[model samples]
Target: MNEQHTVPQAGRRLIGLYPARYRELYGEDIAATFAEATEGLTGRALLRERLDLASHALRLRLRIASTDPAGRILAGAAPIALALGVGESLYDQAWYVEDVIRAVSRVATRPALAAGTLGAYAALVVPWIVALLCAAAGRWKPARRAAVLGLLAETAFWELILGHTWQMYGEFARIALLAALVLLAPADLVDTGRRGRWEVTGLAIGAGLPLAALAASDATVLGVFWQSVPALLPIWAFAVAAALLLAHLSARRPDLFRAAGIALGTVPWLLEQLPRRVPTVWAATAFVVLIGGAVALGGIIRLLRRAIDTEPAEPA
Candidate 1:
């Protein structure tokens, strides 16, 4: 009886490595499975079984953290990443503070530059404010639209005023876009009832005003394209592709969508590490594309297989 009881005890101890919530729900099942798997194993074989269980448990924990709706992992992660990007920019451009203060001080002397500067900042920040408010209130569509508007505002500011050079500010703006996408892609948000046409028009108007002002300020179409496309296209492609993919998967496999979003959120940091960590931008781009594509493909395959398995086995 002592020897027979020891195996189950050992299995329970190993299963404790998972989170309290997970253990509470699945601990008994895990221990029972572990005991069944190792019933007759001993020595090296038993050690291997335990190691496999440990590794599998860790993976399961990571999977839960990545995909748990209660956790809202990607929803929270993207904003934090954006905040970090902003903090990093502020640290690097500490002089931007003095410059802003000086700019404000000379509002009377250099009204045009000062007004333009202030306007640029306003254009950039206001939409972010709108997005955050909408997101906080669970108005997902408007939140996403507001974030897109903010990106356009930033693009206009860069093209018309900042000479179109890439900078950390751009990174922060992109991160904001991703955060909005994260909010918009959740399965619950996707299942919400259709929005009214007027609501859609209102969002369009809200986004358009900033663009129109930028155009009036001589942010030409050609210049905006030249400045924004190279930097923005890849991000746009990935964001749209991932959002659509996740939205589709969210209907049936929300865990997959959330997990994929969490992975997508890491792409920016991976890209950032390329210049020094990787030999070339091309290589880094390929690496990201390959890895992202592979993961997406694998998940899609699994979803398809599950769908097939669930379909009533045809008229046989």
Candidate 2:
């Protein structure tokens, strides 16, 4: 095997890591480039090149590379969604803490139960809070790692403490979605423009409105707010959606990418909420309808924009 033939063969194998469409379009060019680049490379140099190629290919496959619009949108939305999730989870945790405190009141009678409740609360809440703080501060790598830890803690909490149940499935789905977004969305691609402002405003309104409502209520403790915690998911979703819609409508031109990002960000909440709020028989139907409606709305906006663009000029 001469160096010439070996180089192309190795290049071709590396190119195979990309998606089918990518491979079809750029495989030859990439292979040629790879061969030329690695002509005399060996040892650590060759290993580094291979690692770089593999990582780039994986990023493209995940659609989370810096150049991918999906990546930017997801990355921009991930932090916003993480913030909302953290707020909701914190509220939920307050309920858990209240329960723990009450359990502690009876610690003398049931010491093991009280200790277990406190430990469970800590395990479930700490990592998520850490992730949220890290995301808010723009330290996304740590945020992602913390989110993964939170997901693992959540899973253990569900399986060992809560026991496997329908509610557990819903909770797991929400946590898994959050973790996926955190892991998959490249932080460097987060939009720091108008979309960023919209995300910030959405996070504020989504998380704030609920707290305001809670504060307005005469209840002094979270126990009174427990029944409403499930409802908080949809409420936050609605607030964020409304903010994003307002941003889209206010823009000089519609941004389908922004709309798509909004939809993607909403999925976790939608999936988690519908199951909890809607009847079992109607949950799937509602999910489909809501998603279809969003797509249809985007299409309608596009059509309207096209019609305006194609309108004939009027004479004075």
Candidate 3:
């Protein structure tokens, strides 16, 4: 009875990290969930649970804040102070997509637009194809599906980012994003347990190398594909790699990982755009990536809170 009445201190600390509006609304429930997830805790154990939760929240917040576009859209004297600084960051990033696209279009060379569009279309197809191929392996699962959603979100953001550049052998942000999504979502096929067992390995190999190649591409190599089929190679590779990473993370916590990965990816793109050598198109791309990431986080937090809130409360 004493234990039942006693609340976990560390767990409360973890809950404190949430947006106050969130804490005010659902703080007790989250605290309870933390306790449940970290059952059988003592002093150090409680501290670890609290630390993890706080760290996760802090990391995500900083990542979103660093985004240039997100920061701009979120910019204001009042918004930051309100909702403990999470709401402004949570605004729908898609709202700004049109603006970003238009800004990017101004600097796009005909060749760059053509290459990017081709890349975008190709990125669109890769995930569905991968999902179809994995159908036989039975990769379908709820966690995986969630992972895929995260991936698609990531891909769309990257496609927007890379689409702005005219480089030949550029990274397949879309493809990687697609593959990542596929891994997170229902597999194209599900072949019983064997499907996940063997096919998972194949999927990993299929996705990883290509994305690495595309991401690592530089001036000379990318220029070779400036007007040709080789440009498609990076696209294909990225789709596969995204699939692999998403699959792995889905089994873990795809939501948090996606937030981290997408936010971090935007930093580099933005930095590349800050200098003249980087190009104006890329700067526009960075703007969208950062803003988009913040929006994504907001959506996820809302969805999570809703889901958690739906459950009935337990007796104290």
Which number leads on TM-score?
2
Each candidate: RMSD? 19.7, 6.5, 19.7
lDDT per residue for candidate 2 within 22-65, as digits (tens), equals 88887767776778778788999988788677767888998778
- Model 1, span 1-316: residue lDDT tens: 3232445666766787787787778766777678888988889999989976775566456653335563354543343233222222322233334456777999999998887766765666677667655654556557556666766675675567666444544344455555544443332323222432222223333323433343335454555542242323233333333443444344544555335544554455434322333223543464367446656666677778788879997696
Better of 2 and 3 by lDDT: 2
Model 2 off-target regions past 4 Å? 1-55, 103-115, 192-205, 208-232, 253-255, 273-316
* Candidate 1 global lDDT: 0.50
- Estimate candidate 3's alpha-carbon lDDT, on a 0 to 1 scale: 0.40
**List of clashing residue pairs for candidate 1:** none
Clashes of each: 0, 0, 32
TM-score of 3: 0.26
Where model 1 places Cα greater than 4 Å from the true spot, the runs are: 1-97, 164-254, 272-316
Q: In candidate 2, residue 113 scores what lDDT?
A: 88
